[model samples]
Target: MGQRTFAEWLERDMINAYIMSPDSALSPLFLVERQKLESMLLGEQIKNIITCEEVDRKERHEKLEKWIRRLEMTGFEKVPLSYNGRIEATNLLQRYSHKYKFKEEHDCLLVCWSDRPLFSVSAWKFRR
Candidate 1:
């Protein structure tokens, strides 16, 4: 099978197998991770399966919150409560608060990490 076809099959198998024996196959941490991943996947699937714009908006917001929490817990400092918008992320850097900057450019939030930017967050993208 093609790579995309195999990936689809694998994702389906992961969900099906987890459903069939969640307790047996998944450790507590793995279960939590799986739940997060499943929530993200199911939200995307909902966007594809249903056409309601409201549902899509809610799902996207929920997903963004999930990601933000995940990032914070992984040591990405949370910006001050007074700050908002895309630049808020860069504003959270304690040491580089003055030099490092972020801007909304090219339809994306650009974070400039200078040579001396604070590197507080771990390299790992996800936590167990």
Candidate 2:
């Protein structure tokens, strides 16, 4: 599949921090390796950066839902790596208003997607 991986596309966005949840635990050695990769992409060594976030399962769950809602607000319907812009999928990164948040500090806004349909973004689903 000659397509850009998420990390590849992410590099173009140049987001300040890419938040890896505490749930995705990695060994110290592996974590170091990942930090190295991140530093390479960022062009700086962000040493002493906090690796783990202190959040309860409940809060993590809540935050995840909130992000999904925002993503749905973006009006993108295709999956990120394969989205073609007419298939009725959802994307959340588009900012219609003049104001948007761009993090320069070690903070990132995290989002995830599943098998939701296009035209689902920027709208709601109601079921009984």
Best by TM-score: 2
Which numbered prediction scores highest in lDDT against the true structure?
1
Off by over 4 Å in 1: 1-24, 52-128
Candidate 2 displacement at residue 4 in angstroms: 35
Model 1, CA-based lDDT: 0.47
RMSD values, in order shown: 15.2, 17.2
The 0-to-1 C-alpha lDDT of every candidate, in the order given, reads 0.47, 0.37
lDDT of 2 by residue, 1-128 (tens): 79987755554333234423222356989887876676575432222122224542122222434656565577533233223432222222333222222221112222222221111222234322
TM-score per candidate: 0.22, 0.23
- Alpha carbon lDDT at 83, candidate 1: 38
